[model samples]
Target: MGMHKDQRACRRVDCHDRPILSYGHMVRIAHVTDCYLPRTGGIETQVRALARHQAASGHEVSIITATPGVKRSGTEIVDGLAVTRITAKIPGDLPIHPRTRHHVAAALQENPVDVVHVHVGVISPFAWGAIRAAYQLKIPTVVTVHGIWGPLASPGYRLSELIAKWATWGITISAVSQVAAKTIERAVPTLGEVLVLPNGIDVQDWQLPVRQHDSSTLNLVTVMRLAPRKRTLPLLKIVKAAQERAGITMRIHLRLVGDGPERSRAESFVHQHGLKNLVSFTGRLDHAGIREIFAMSDVYVQPSVKESFGIAALEARAAGLPVIARSQTGTTQFIRDHQEGLLAQTDSGMASAIASLAADRALLAQLGEYNRSTAPEQSWPMVLARVDEAYARARHLD
Candidate 1:
């Protein structure tokens, strides 16, 4: 279901009676996740950044993860942040452990914290275990859902509720976006509240050279892992459809950045569609390289309808480029239709949006200029405020 304006407006569920944390009080926070440093995916990166930001603000922060360290399992200082790894020697070093709850409980007992923040994807075993442990210890726990949990995952949550009765445990639940929160609400109706605590970005870092567009060629760029769930092939099809809609006179070049399991298949699709000349696949590029591309690109396109939060799309918008994203995604939190960029409800709609922008340079420039001048709401300061409030709310629950 699409998120209406009212639903999106309720980003933070209000807590009038709850006690707020005293200003200048030092807070000890423990962040639990399945992934961390040496494994830099979206969840891992967000958890790491959030923990570091908390630490920088004079709060004591530490991390407990299932991701292995150099040793099998140990504690180490990672970039000044203490990371406790509770991992076994599993194949591929997969972030999973049968005794995750036990280890997490031990870690929390070893160093008591004001709140335990657990990060989760659709089905994060380790994170769930950590939540269970925190609940058993009566520690104030907050869970941040970091992925799209559709109907397929509903049964698992139902089972979790049945087995653990977690919904009755008074833990504060949150999702990264409004759309995601609504879906999780539909899945687990018994939860007390599902807050919208979005991921944070350093908007200042994207302050690269202002984008100078060459209105001649329609240059589109998207940076994402080419996984099936990411809809890599569908992205290519949309780019092709947009080109066809724009007509042969308009030269369209799509820079497909990042690589994953679908890379080979997506490359095959591009070649089969006779789009080798129009689309170029660049496996992976660092932040600096992406900023350089942002300067040259006219628009950023993300074709994933299930994107919980399009961080790359946010980065592109931060770098002064108008973005094209699905209307149902968390990207909508930043990009409003016809404001920062156009939003599409379907693949054909996305194609139409691209073609419409290609035809109307005035609207395109206006959106781009608006994005370039305005800052996104997901800045560290604002996100930190929301997280602090979440912590306070969790403490109240405890």
Candidate 2:
């Protein structure tokens, strides 16, 4: 009887004309990530945005993520995506990977998805379980490598590479950025099928009314974790140098918006350097708050010695703020030397770039204009379309 109804439904012209079937509903996808909401980072934001967009586009979308300490029992629908958070034993206060085999096995049995997309970063036990479950079920998998793996060189990297090679395909967010892509390819040559999809921002958010600020008082902002890799101390040093080198006596205010293990060190650096008057720390904030900070700032600077995509810089560009970023890593891809924004390779170079932008109002306005024009191309909608296309190719291969 069910078969007869399904056949009749398939034959009905109205049913055949449904948007779901017409616009790629034939593909059911399960997006797997180690961290979801509550745990914030570039990877988490990308996963949430991609999943929300995919679900809204009529694809059968679901997420399998590790539950935070306060576990929510059972599956919950969030923004139309079914999110299943599984509990895991905390080994010495650290949340290990969830024993997801049984839960994933059950989810797969119920839904029988077509493909699984894993957002790779911060290798936890849960990530391992997801990889194992996907492979055991004969489901084709695609892993998105969000960060460079060489420096970490941990057991997690080896395990992640093994799973990525076994998966149907591998993808890197900064594919066009040679540095980021090459790093991954070096680690695992079997990841040759990797495609780059640059992280995007909502262009609409960048269109906010530019806060009127005195050009003489430059408001510079860097939104990143207070870690050694971010090179926040160097940024503070550069700001101090700017005051002396430029002789402008500009009231340069540096707002650092993320906290980490290096928070105390960063704070101490600010005090030791007597930059307490010039720098302020606003603990990590939500996306909206970050955007608001960008909207008010005259300039955005990212000094990370190593960055995969530098999503913060992208967000700043979308907000029409002139950016001064390091030329190292994937940041160089978005910043054109003297064209869209300034790129500095060394501490002096970064300081010089910031000073130059501060001294020239016309140049700052031009860079801001260029950023606004180019930001729309990197919107999440376009990025997700590329992602969906990649999923289609993975499905075909399967």
Question: What is the lDDT of every predicted structure here?
Answer: 0.82, 0.70
lDDT of 2 by residue, 1-398 (tens): 11224433443233212222222334667887777876767788878877777766666788887755245536787776788776556664343444677787677656656677876653556665776787676665666667664566686467545645554333222243456677766665665645776676667866666567887777899899887867877888998887666665667778889999889988998888788878999999887888888877888988876687887887787788877877776776577788768888888888888778778889988888777666646777778777766665554532
**Model 1 lDDT tens row, 263-300:** 99988999898999779988899988988888889999
Q: Estimate each model's TM-score.
A: 0.91, 0.84
Runs of candidate 2 with Cα error greater than 4 angstroms are 1-26, 69-73, 92-95, 122-124, 150-164, 167-178, 210-212
Weakest 10 consecutive residues of candidate 1 by summed lDDT = 10-19
Query: What TM-score does model 2 achieve against the real structure?
Result: 0.84
Window of ten residues with lowest summed lDDT in model 2? 14-23
Error of 2 at 170 (Å): 9.3
| Model 1 global lDDT (CA atoms, 0 to 1) | 0.82
**Once model 1 is optimally superposed onto the true structure by TM-score, how far is the C-alpha of residue 362 displaced, in angstroms?**
0.7
